[model samples]
Target: MKAALVNRKMGLFLALAGILALAVAWWVEHVLHIMPCELCLVERWPWRILILIGVVDILLPGAAGGPVLWLAVPVLLTSIGLAACHVGVEWQWWPSPLPGCHAPHISGHTMAERLASMPLLPSKPCDAPTYLIPDLPISMSMMGGLYAAGILVAFCVWKYRVAHTARRIFY
Candidate 1:
């Protein structure tokens, strides 16, 4: 009974956190007028998936919430990976796998055709890092990676405690 309550609370926390992360990203892009690179856009997907999982975890029966919450671990891991890749691109460690991260190659010979081939909105290059804070050296991707890692650690600790309690009860 207590486990279920804890799980529900955890789920709620995760869902809210994910929503906040997305909202901040949107605010940065729309309100702050900061353009996100293709890789930055790609990094948002895992959080969306995590939010869905979190919603499910909240809706499920208390006993069922634990396993559903477990699903977020892998999703968070994926988020961390995406953030790392984006950070790598920002660091110029390697080229971005996303084609949109690169400049569009207009092959059309005619001026009209070239204009049509051009992207509707100019894309920010992946290598360019956007610092959220004035003096902070950390980029958005690095912050995301850190946040994901922190959540992952918390989940692991929760799982360990659950296992420890179960062992005490069974043995």
Candidate 2:
């Protein structure tokens, strides 16, 4: 026997979770003024996708039982990958994959040309990690991984039975 769920309710829950994740990141970045590295920004992409899926599923009744739920697995996986990469960079286990991580590109021949071409603010280095709480060993990327894992687990628990039913119906 399996417990039944309204797909729309599940979708709404997921959408709200997505929004809260982004909100936390934004709060840290904007209100707390903690800068993010390239990988940190990349980690948010999956959450953004999830938010979109959730919102769409909520608005369109037909979308709930469609392909939206299955997409969560891949998006969560992507988030995990991004966070792991960031963690590696933070720990000096490996170098960041981004070219800009090496250094900002200065193509200009002269110092003046380079200065003129440069933006007002340079991006934060990916090698360095920011801790949200003082004196804490955990880095932001690790927190992101934790967040992703929590949401993924919750999502799996929420939709496990429904997914099988969906597969049976579709295939």
Candidate 3:
């Protein structure tokens, strides 16, 4: 019916949203050569989960898919929380939760000992925010938080419409 078609369309939209966010992140990191902090890397997990759930919902029957998409609500919330944490770190409101977000301090008396204690890989500090544009005044994490909030609002509206229509159909 019409409802099923709408559900499938929303599922596709949600899947594409996740894909777009990840794609931008990849492009920023690979194409632009901007390194991501540990917290930035951590924030992507919710999107990945959303992508999986959205794809599953798209594959399922319309009625069944609705509930699956509901699972994305919490995941989106988590993403928002992660983004806020990142923003806070960037603004110096608080330190990052991840140890990797901070530069490791190598303590040693001898040169050989200091060299041995140094980390093998380079890491970007979470407090240093990456701006996508020159002097944009908005960090990537802030933009991500806003994007997640928008998606959450859209999903809520979709669910509300579906529920209202169901009431009219049943009652």
**Which tens-of-lDDT digit does each residue in 1-171 have in candidate 1?**
777777888888788878988998999999999999988888899889888878888888476777888789889999999999988889889999999999899878899999999999999999999999989999999999999999889878877897899899989
lDDT of each: 0.88, 0.81, 0.89
Sort the predicted structures by lDDT, highest score first. 3, 1, 2
Candidate 1, residue 41: lDDT: 87
Number of backbone collisions per candidate, in order? 0, 0, 0
What does candidate 3's lDDT look like per residue over 4-106, in tens digits?
A: 6777788888889999999999999999999998999999888888888888878883778867888889999999999999999999999999999888999
TM-score, every prediction:
0.91, 0.84, 0.92
Pitting candidate 2 against candidate 3, the one with the higher TM-score is: 3
Among these predictions, the greatest lDDT belongs to 3
**Taking the tens digit of each residue's C-alpha lDDT, what string does model 2 give over 1-171?**
122236677678778888998999999999999887778788889989998877776666553544676688898888888999989988999999987566776668998998887756788889899888889999888988888899899888767767687699889
User: What local lDDT score does residue 123 receive in model 2, on the 0 to 100 scale?
Assistant: 86
User: How many angstroms is residue 98 displaced in model 3 relative to the true structure, after the best TM-score fit?
Assistant: 0.7
lDDT of 2 at 136: 90
Give model 3's TM-score versus the native structure: 0.92
